[model samples]
Target: MSNELYHKCHEAISQGRAILEDLQQWDFETIIQYPQAEPQSTASHLSTTAMPSTEKTTLAEMESGLKGCSLCSLAKQRKNIVFGAGNPRARVVLVGEAPGREEDEQGIPFIGEAGKLLDKILLAMKLSREEVYICNVLKCHPPGNRDPQPDEISACEPFLKQQLALIKPELIITLGRFAAQELLKTTQPIGKLRGQWHEYEGIPLMPTFHPAYLLRNPSGKRPVWEDMKKVMQRLG
Candidate 1:
């Protein structure tokens, strides 16, 4: 082994010994060590070498991976993979439920009239779609715009988690009850979830009415505006 590899082995042993000492009640002798055999070429060894880095897979790579994914039944009926699009390094990420007719057709989230409303709302805050990331809980659209089944959400959750990990947003704004409930893992209604700051995997989450819902209930815009104010304050 190289000097670096020797040092790494020593550090690992020291850490293991510390853990064993701390957990005195447990048997540490049962620990297993699996060694990887060396490859033939220097290129192969370089490929296998581990590096300390935080960069994640690109959004395009993620979408490509999901293109053929059949993790849930939604894959069968989906006309397109609404894999989400926007700035990958966005500070804010807007999460919604599943796709609708336009979204399914275009393979993008938050399109059509609802999307238009979202655009206006963002403009009012002096932000544009290019400035933030947008995605849905389900990458594929549920037929007839129905609520995503629990199993479907579970199947597609890892993609969302990966997107979050890659974006590493300072704030996440969930639209509608389903988005809030699914991301926050709470059964609370939108009314209860809104107007207060919450945390999802350590990132600040703000739940508010969906743009489609806002189109239906224009009166509720007041509270949504309140929630938006909080988001802007934090982002500022």
Candidate 2:
């Protein structure tokens, strides 16, 4: 595929993830008011800026707000957006870094080999995909499967905040260094980040190695399992 076409595919993937991020917001209502003559120009508030204040919010409406967003350049190269799947009101939520090549292609989080392993891990937790909501810090795949850029994360923050605000999950499990670090707003390494409980928006967060990491270092699986067991114990 030509470079232009390839990048366009990634842009679409981003759009897909943004839609998924907003899907569950349909369950809750936010106050909506008419906008003024001119809205402020802010990348972080891209979605809300275009729309009036919402008393009742829907994922569809949220998605509409994000339409035509160019808060960051990532939008230009995206093919589709990947959204979270499963229960909207789930008690647990899992956050990852960004879409991989496979995730971007499918516009679904965790559908690749790593996702398959995540499935098994969920099974070990005595949970199914239906019981939780899954998403990434970035809705779109980073070009070349690289780590998410700071500007991209900044642009996408509102979508994530809205999801957390709406779902109000009892526990949040962060996968990988970026997800954990970004959520924690710390530069600490994943080694220091994992194996403990952190807080985000008043919800309990547990950091663990990404399935991709476990694939690279099989020894990491045991710790991830231990972390899940802690999460299971906490749920009880």
Candidate 3:
């Protein structure tokens, strides 16, 4: 086979393997409780602090620690932790895949141009950042801001789960495909994931486009608006 065909075959095989792995772990009933297993160390430096105490550490302190975390390989390349910011006790939580260059520099989630668009969307819903919590599936920025690897998600998921447990939000808004897929544990495309309400550990989850994606594909905004309306209706 020619080199180009050989590369295509390799890509296909890799995708197949990923799908198989995703399917094997797609048990909706499995509730991942907190204070669970620790992640294996990566190239990034691990902190000396103990696992965040359920009660002792305030959300701010926990976030501070997370910002300094070096639990995964992304830490080595990241400029900042991109730990989520906003009202810790917010009723709605917005979860994305990971940080990008802008977010990494600011050490905040959803603050870039895409973040600005998100703000507009939230305002359209008559909501503000102070009213809701925003976070990413992975705390650190992935290289080139590419999609997060499965292992990276696995390593970072526990922290997000812990945050959810602590905040105990009424609803979760999964921004974009990665967040929806990881939280919902489905191989279905984002088109199917949207326009529906799913549950995660009893919290209502609404999937929508990532602001960054909407920046590229303006037409996607319509469905995302629909999803936001559902969130508003539920919250209202």
TM-score of each: 0.76, 0.75, 0.76
lDDT of 2: 0.82
Per-residue lDDT of model 1, residues 23-138, tens digit only: 44332223434477755554344333332121337776667545455566666677898888899999999999988989999988899899999998899888999999999998
Better of 1 and 3 by TM-score: 3
> Which candidate leads in lDDT?
1
In the range 1-236, model 3's lDDT, one tens digit per residue, is 99999999999999998876774454222333445456745442343323333232457756654544555567678888876878878999999989989888988898889999999999999989999999999988898888898667867888888888888999999998989999999988888998799999999999888999999999999989988888889988
Q: After superposition, how far is residue 45 of candidate 2 from its true place, in Å?
A: 16
Worst 10 residues of 3 by lDDT: 47-56
Residue pairs in candidate 3 whose N, alpha carbon or C atoms collide under 3 angstroms? none
Task: Report the poorest 10 consecutive residues by lDDT, candidate 2.
Answer: 47-56
- The superposed Cα distance between candidate 1 and the true structure at residue 25, in angstroms, equals 49
TM-score of model 3 relative to the true fold?
Answer: 0.76
RMSD of candidates 1 onward, in order: 13.6, 12.6, 17.2
lDDT of each: 0.83, 0.82, 0.81
